[model samples]
Target chain A: MNRRDGDTCSSTPDDSLAREERRLGWTLVAPALGVVLLVAIAPLAWTVWESFHHHDLRMPWLGRSFVGLANYRELLGTPRFWASLAHTAFFAVASVSLELILGLVLALAMQRASRGRALIRATVLVPWALPTVVAALLWRFLFQSDAGVVNAVLIAAGVLDQPVVWLAGTVTAWVPVILADVWKTTPFVALLLLAGLQGIDPTLHESAAIDGAGRWRVLTRITLPLLRPAILVALVFRTLDAIRVFDLIYVLTGGGPGTATEPVALYTFSALMQNLRFGYGAALSVTIFAVAFLLAVIYVRLLGADDGRGGSTT
Target chain B: MDSLAAACRASFLLLVLGACGGGRADPRPVVTISGSAVGDEGAILRRQMDRFMELHPAVRVELRQTPDDASQRHQLYVQWLVARAEDPDVLQLDVVWTPEFAAAGWLSPLDRFAPEAAAFFPATIEANRWDGSLYAMPWFVDVGLLYRRTDLVPEAPVSLEMLPALARAAMAGAGAPGGPPPPAAGWVWQGARYEGLVTVYLEILTAHGGRIMDDSGRVVVDDPPGVDALTFMRDAIRRGVSPREVLTWHEEETRFAFQNGDAVFMRNWPYAAALLADSVRSQVAGRVGVSTIPAARGSGGRPASALGGAQLAINAHSDVPDLAWLLVSFLTAPEQMLERAEAVGQLPPRPALYDDARLAAALPLGVRVAREAVASAVPRPVTPLWSELSERLQIALHSALAGQVEPGPALHTAAADMNALLERSGLRYGMNAP
Candidate 1:
């Protein structure tokens, strides 16, 4: 009837087909785009806009005088901000580095046919499952300078004459916080790396053995190169998490011992939430997000990592 | 004819639905109030709330339990206040917030409600007043007091100067004849760097005949007397007469240490006295003694205690201010105040409630401490801007104690910041060009 049904719309097929393709693709992706805009894009935009205004909780009127970059300028001059950034960088680099190494060892340990492997796997998930606050409180109790078990043991063994306040001085507060973070989040890193290790075929290891590859050589030559993507993914994920840590440090020490434990997130939190300086808090948040995003960019480019869910494996 | 009948019935149903959903008395404002000490005695608050509801019969009240520590409570309460949602009509504001919350305009002033407020303790009354007006009504009161182990010392701290030596001597006695030093704390206080720091610092300053902010409300802590007070705090800590933990101890920790008979002298609130003397936990229950914080300098400048209490205020924006004020008044009435004091450990908001023998018997020591402390308790500066000034005080006191900066500079910093805050708030600090 319309120029024979099988003619494939000879006059209008390409244009119609193109329109159909665009409609189907866009409709399929529209929901995901909407979700991203609602959550990530909208809040980010709102925070950026709020950063330019000066306001507090008492009078919540918007659109004050445009004092461009003044809030950021004031913050840069403040020692607390600079110190907190230094603290954040130190915490991120130290925690993530320790986690990466510890996670590798744990995965390697689990890879071997060790007794109680299932039990260890099950128990390893406990720290990962426990709320961050719970872990912090437990560790805080253990580290109490006066009556804590750690100090008691040290004193009883004649190793030291008296109990040292593990969280007393600014320099020392880092120990308890990093120790808590490592205890709670190291398991997550191990679990991710373990998945990668397990995904590698055992035949590859067997072939390396047949080729007279030593354990060290096999690990360096085959296992590590194969596990690089997983490691990179784990590093990126944990680095982001470590940088934004709040509850663990908040509950453990409360950014105390003279603000030695003050991380950037905690600083922004105290400024915005406790101090009720909304505009300054927004500026600080924007700075943190920018730094974290830059770190992510550096990680992806240098490691050249890809998501494992893609066509190729580690 | 059948279709017309069906249409008539559908329209009737629609009319009923619209009537039911569209307009009515508030279905019940779901309110949440947090308390740490309510415990099993929470029914007292509910029953009192029920009495308020009887007069109105429509407004509902709910009380939520919060942890006792003010810092932890500060974190959650700020989130709610900042959000400024209208559901929580009545808030029990900490006395320290008289400046901060009032300055922020978060509180609805009591002047709008026309409350019957004459019976309240004048200090408590004055404590709730911010600027030239009253913002809240006293619901209860708590003030810091000094506690000592009678076995160690039968007298009050004779003077602020004598405290360090007395603590050292008391500790030596507590140590066994040949055994190691006493496992117990020697002296305990809320030396932790927090809002509590402000309360304790002001107590010392007032005792020393120094004012943090003067009559005209200029920052005046940079003087010699202020430095002397701060020096005493630093020396007390450095000498180890007070525990290293004192630098970290808030009310509960210090209370725990002192109540366990570990401390010879402890500075804390009166609530700890009952718990310590009760057979359940304390070692020095009968042996414990109560008094004021040591005198500052001469007889003229007597020791001043930091007043800690809460109040009930009607939300200005509330559609039912009458009912809200009604609820607030009933909760603070003498009869309910007596019940709240007896059950929830609240010191009565009214001066006359102190005459209730039954209430006193329930909280004997707490009442005694309240009467003595409130008589001379200097309210923290009631200027709306004092909250920012308070944080500056904390930083000053802390840095001075840590030996990071001299007390002179620390107080100077506090003064400058306070002056700026006061200026921004449209208030004059005394030193203005006038």
Candidate 2:
């Protein structure tokens, strides 16, 4: 310290001022860092630690013991675990893609509207505003086999000869689940895209028109290319949310029709809360976290590259 | 502003400390019981607690309201007992949970309390016992029954083979002319993939002479009897004797179908009898009758009803186990059971109660038929791993019913998975015994 101080003696005033500022910044951010460590990092660390143990709350007679990847090994071999992972991936891909396309169309419509735009936007937000569980329940009622409106309408319209048990079929059960997810979250995606649309220069569209670019060409070349960042953001958010989906599917189908629609989060919940296998549940949770984190990292990299190019272009 | 914040914090701390310390000085021992306290159940329980307190004049009993849903309550109790919480000295447990709780050492054995185990139905008593000790007392009993419309069919079907024919005839309006329009479906049961599905399957499985686990604790549900049972259920859905919609129905859904006179036969619990008898809401109000699910033909099997109900047990970590026992015994006594039956239509666990004329009058289903059903009742395998095993079985059964797999293959897979779970948990040996 004395040697460093001697070396910087000539620049002492400025260096000390910089050091003081750095210390003040640290002091200012300490509470937030503490909170992050306490709330987020601590529980995560505990779960990771628990994942290595053999702890079943309902089977305490076995005693909690360190098993060292045994839970993960068991999870890997379990068919139900693999099935649930596939279900999660299928749900995320299916729901997010549908949301993006529908959301993009909705955003374009909203942007082009000149009258009652506020009313249209507000009405579109209603589904998003409703709680996911409530929306899921609403969809469930609509798809019920006997008295559900969907079956009734389909039969009446001659689309079907009779009412189909929507939730009873393994493949058919995913309909309401995906439909509910898309219905509840598309508005948020559209709103994000709408904001992005507003950020685009209207003069760019006018110039494209003067240059003889058709509507489709302008949309494909100018609007879509510029809307890439917003689209990516919405994709990352919705995909992450979709991968960890629980309550909507929980209320709609309960991951049933023989666990056909069970997602990773619901599986973890059953192990943790229902079966009380804390150790196995922790392992399941850690695995889900790892998958979500990997996706996030990929999304962040894409966003970073897009931002750099976007900055250069603008 | 800082001073005011500091004063508020000090006051909050003082308030918490005061509240904690306030209850320490009471001379009378206070015992808390956690259970369903919803609607009439709540009122009856409070009245009983007051009466017990009056009788004792020493120990104070308190009711801690818990979720009415069995699984939710089980989760809450597991959390509390795992934490060794001394309050909620008593717990209301589902029938299948007693063994699990006892094995976990979360329940106090009632052998020391000298409970008269013989008074309760043997199956109910058997369900409450773990490792040669009674861990809980059955407070009430629930047994599955085949509810048929008397006006549609004069008598209950005598056997499983006879059910479809009888149901078809009833659907074709075979009984008296100009009765309620022939029901739309033939039979309905809880076929949803949950615990209720397991219970429904248990009745069928037993009727086909199959057991989930043998007395030696070996998984044998994939055997021929089990396959026959599953096939019978699947065929019901396939043959249109039972509606495919039943694949998504739970107890209440089936009850709704039967209550609306849309089904000729409905399998449900004793709780539905009173609700079905309400003429204002029920179309089959004056037309219902109850019987055990009949034995499958030539299977060497007998009629069986799945055993279910709530059991009361003292928390092993309780500060006042004896007081909790007092509460348990008081609640399970004939008087309280009769009161509960009269008030909420809960079936008493005691076999002798069926002989009581008052019980005959209290239960809308009548004691004789309830007794027969209870007599035929079969408890699900008593093991700490019951919930896990049941979950696997439920999924497998549901998958077969939904046509995702054959009944034989599904049960085989379930059996394999269940056995693996048992072995992995170190319960395949005699580890579960302790």
Positional deviation of residue B410's Cα in model 2 after best superposition, in angstroms: 0.5
Off by over 4 Å in 1: A1-19, A59-63, A114-117, A199-213, A305-314, B1-37, B51-61, B64-68, B71-84, B116-118, B174-183, B298-301, B354-362, B366-369, B399-434
| Candidate 2 CAPRI assessment class | medium
Show what share of the native A-B interface contacts model 1 retains: 0.15
State which candidate has the highest TM-score: 2
| Pairs of residues at least 3 apart in sequence or in different chains that clash in candidate 1 | none
Model 2 pairs in collision:
none
CA shift at A143, candidate 2, in angstroms?
1.1
Residues A73-139 of candidate 1 have per-residue lDDT tens digits of: 9789877799889988899999999999998998898878579989988888899899887788888
Per-residue error (Å), model 2, residue A311: 2.5
Classified by CAPRI criteria, candidate 1 counts as: incorrect
- Report how far residue B3 has shifted in candidate 1, in Å: 66
Model 2 agreement with the true structure over B1-434: per-residue lDDT tens digits: 22223335445534643665554666888998878776788899999999999999998887676656566667778778878899689988999999888988888889998999988888888888887888999998889989998887779888899998998887876445665568889999999878998998889988888889886777888999999999999999998999999988878789989998899899999989999999999988888898899998889889999999999999999999988998999999999999999998899988888889899998888888889988888988888888988999999999999999999999999999998888776765443343
